[model samples]
Target: MTDKNIIWHKVLDDKKELPEGRVKTVTAAHKGICLTHYKGKFSALDNRCPHQGGPLGEGSIENGLLRCPWHGWDFDPCTGHPPGGYDDGIDTFPIKEENDAIFVGLEPEKPHETTVSDIMVETMINWDVTKVFGMVGHSNLGFADAMRRQEEKGNLNFYGIRHEGAAAFAASAYGKLTGKPAACFSIAGPGATNLYTGLWDAKVDRAPILAITGQVKTQVVGTGNFQEVDLVQGFNTVAEFNQRIQRDSRHAELMSLAIKHAILKRDVSHLTLPDEIQELKASSRAKAKTSKNRITPLTIAPPKEAVDEAVKLIKKAKRPVIIMGHGARNHKKEVVKFAERLNAAVLTTFKGKGLISDDHPLGGGVLGRSGTPIASWFMNECDLLIVFGASFSNHTGITPKKPIIQVDFDPLALSKFHQVEVAVWGEISRTLEIFQEEIKGETSAINPRNEIAARWKIWKEEKTKRLSETSDKGISSIAIFEAMNKVTPENAVMCVDVGNNAYSFGRYFEPKNQDFLMSGYLGSIGFALPAAIGAWAAVGNSRPVIAVAGDGGVCQYLAEITTLVNYNMPVKLIIINNNELGKISKEQRAGEFEVWKTALSNPNFAEFAESCGAWGKRVEHQEDLEQAMKELYDQSKPSVLEIIADVNLI
Candidate 1:
């Protein structure tokens, strides 16, 4: 073995070789590597993408490049340099084949340039203005420790939330915004349970997140000990995989699994560890490595014939509409090109807002509860509905009455109830980009600006009329969103909690780029403040992140106000003082159930923030609300702005 820190160990005897064009997982005593053999030579590197710790081993091989299973960053096996100018080296163990005996070497983690500096690098990465947000619990200690260590190492920083559920929401929103796995950490039992809402959201919404939770003490397994719960079972609520790192020998492997789950599944993963187990010292182990000898098989691209036909349908339609959802967000530029080339008006779902920038000529902003009237009418009147990269959720608040064209990576997402005219399946971004090019070649100049602006003009007229009639002088729900918008910058990021308040915030607030953050699928209310902090940390307080939270949500994680204050990150906490479960109240009124456990008394949150050494103010009137917000924003200090509103608005 060379002094470059190599270990000589036999991988296999002459009896075995990997299947042709396929990689093989070679396990050593304490580590494993995915070996790729090509032309009778082999190459290997660490198995995880340095960015989000995504699985490199499971990634496809194409033209001597190893593509990460998550985010598809391709890396050259020879030098371990990922695409997009990331030249980094992984722990490469030298392989020796002698007389049909194969051996490899492994080394300690060395300082080298990589995709991301550390987990903390997440805090610094641009989310297009979205922030890192989440709660911290005992169960998440290791994950949190890793994040904190990254921050301390000048690699990353995060906003800590009081409730684990909210943290999960923040993670979901952060992930959705950045296409990276944002994280949520909590203690075991209640902590894990609380995080389920966000986890389930991530699962359903296909938002990638890594959820970390603490487990019961290793020594007291199944003893009905305090705070002890079946984490593996509990984690089944939200995660694609519930991975328990019970032994030191399994930590690296479990981490690889976690990364694989988040990236490939495009869902949440839970990494659970017992309290003492995290502190246990283990011998140096080998990190998983990428293979050298495999190739990425090309899935036949969706026949271009079908896509060309879809384009023709768009060109002929006088009133065509494009519905952009999660799919569109993933393949933003491509979707934009397609819409523009077709001169089709675009309306995005809440989850996919800003998929096409608000500034785009064809932009209809968003379509839903808070969507402009023009957007709704566009959907209702369009003769053809072309939905790209999005699911038709009830939250969109409208169903297509016309023929629909749906394009997505998942064929199953083409319809919720409506039958699809043309269903094309492939990678959202890649396909969209391809479609755009094809459409450009087939079509001539059409004024997309005129189409979009015409719709926006009508919507703007209706919006103005509606805003004028609405009461803006009291503690109204609409007033809160409006006031916050007025005070915050155009680039402000708003991290919202789940429950009714999230609905209110998402609806009433028209956030542009860097303006809105929500766990659309997760819907965790307490996530607002923490997510704001994370966003602020990520962006270095360049813009303010306001957390619009309800009374119930605020109370669940009241302590995080102090976290904000202590960190001195530029985050504003806006508490909607609806004293009960507002969303449930609305549901009950709609004949769902009699509100029983939902009703509860609350505290003076403004004062609570003050107690935490933050500036706190309670607003009773609408006029005062805006003023107070202005004050909070001007102070640029940690503060809580409370709006005591009617209970109906929660």
Candidate 2:
């Protein structure tokens, strides 16, 4: 028998300096570990989530129970047992508090033999998943079960999104964040089809994503059972690896191949797992498939002659501009260096808004309705545009009348959806590096255009005047968002839903570092609250996450507020309390059609938020907006601030 040897683990200060009931986390043995003080006693557990190694420390805690952030796996802190039949429990260390300091005794080995659940829990303490995102559906339920099993085991974190599209978007977004391949999941049928939007977006944008989906039961294939849809057929449009797991065969090999294809192709890969097969036990010796990251291949240097040609092109041109997109986000340091070498003014699309800091000397925010005046000015004035990882779309209102030098890994993206004068096919950072070297040797200053600068100033003044006038009049959606932005922290994230709300924001709020995650391009409305939960789960309470939804959108997914309140995530939801499907209503009215069909009566949003145990407030007038915001921010809990504004504003 071994005597307990105490090893001190200092948590928060003893003076109640940190707020009571707030969970704090510490990293020990390079593992994210959670510690909390309750009822004058200290408790400690592995911070890594048991299910997928999500940061359990970041998960919400209420009473004496802790829930996993990745999934809502609830557990009692004292016993370390997850609620219900789920036999998962975390390793609890004995703790002692003495002289205002905390100490714990960690056992080198468990008193009992390790099981599969134990492996799942322990692995999350050290291992981390590259990326995980996807929609939740029936066939994928088994995968979700696998994820839950991993969570019980505690080794990694998987982030969930609203739809298959949102999942792919999140994976691509995370890839941009980490410069590595991200993992995504989806279900069969419609779920598979919805994935194309994000997968194609990833393809055009040149992002790496690993996508998984649930297929129909092998026996049901052609028989057309419930949810039995052709996943391979649906996924053919966007996925580089569209694989349906074989029946009664080597399933692990296929999963491994799917994972490998995603990494190697630098594109989206889709793997469809049948319902029963996904639940079947894998061989005990099964190992994760591995592959070299495709971004590693930068060996194809630009020929010196090609570099010289690029330099000459730059030197001879006036009003030259560089458009940085998600590609530049991956090779941030290299892109910055390249931009510095040319002294070119930079513009980014909404998706690439923060590829460089908004405060950077050259960045012009984004280019479109939400674009700064400078970006718009340069876009019209520049005769030579150096495009990198940017797609000129209707969203940007971009039309190429001048010579545009396109640089991208996706050959198809070289065009303005089929309009390009000069195309250079290669990796963005590598190509930019070659162009940068050439620019250094060239003599001309690539002089800034005075006309462009003058035009930008005038546009800025006009925009300022318009904003001021708009703010003073009947409450507009823009005014509401601007006010919200002013009160929230600089890093506060805002997740918006599709419909009139998304376009309203896209045309209104200025871009910030806080990611604007949405299901807009697909026009999915019941996405706001859940996606916000996922985003908060990803970033934690280090900052606030706000979900802006319309009355219709909120009504569709209001049940998720229970999840938010229960999780104790400090999220502030703002409902544009216009009691109608504003966009469709307006469209119908414009087309001289009946409006009642598009109109809807909604429940009291403030009451709904309160019902779920969160601070809820209603604001009818502009005068009450700031006060309502202040109250929500000060409450230090998940809350809903419903702002009743004119329906026409949307």
**In candidate 1, which residue ranges exceed 4 Å CA deviation?**
1-152, 155-161, 217-220, 223-226, 246-250, 275-277, 284-305, 356-360, 398-400, 416-418, 441-473, 477-487, 498-508, 578-583, 592-600, 644-650
Write one digit per residue (lDDT tens) for candidate 1, span 533-626.
Answer: 5566555577667777888877766787777777786577888776678777777878967777887687788888889889889988765777
Worst 10 residues of 1 by lDDT: 114-123
Q: Give the CA lDDT, 0 to 100, for residue 8 in model 1.
A: 70
Worst-scoring 10-residue span by lDDT in model 2: 117-126
Best by lDDT: 1
235-268: candidate 2 lDDT, tens digit per residue? 7877888777654555544555554555556567
TM-scores of all predicted structures:
0.69, 0.69
CA shift of 390, model 2, Å: 1.0
Model 2 residue runs over 4 Å out of place are: 1-145, 158-217, 247-249, 263-267, 279-285, 291-306, 332-337, 356-359, 369-373, 441-460, 467-474, 518-530, 552-556, 583-597, 630-636, 648-650
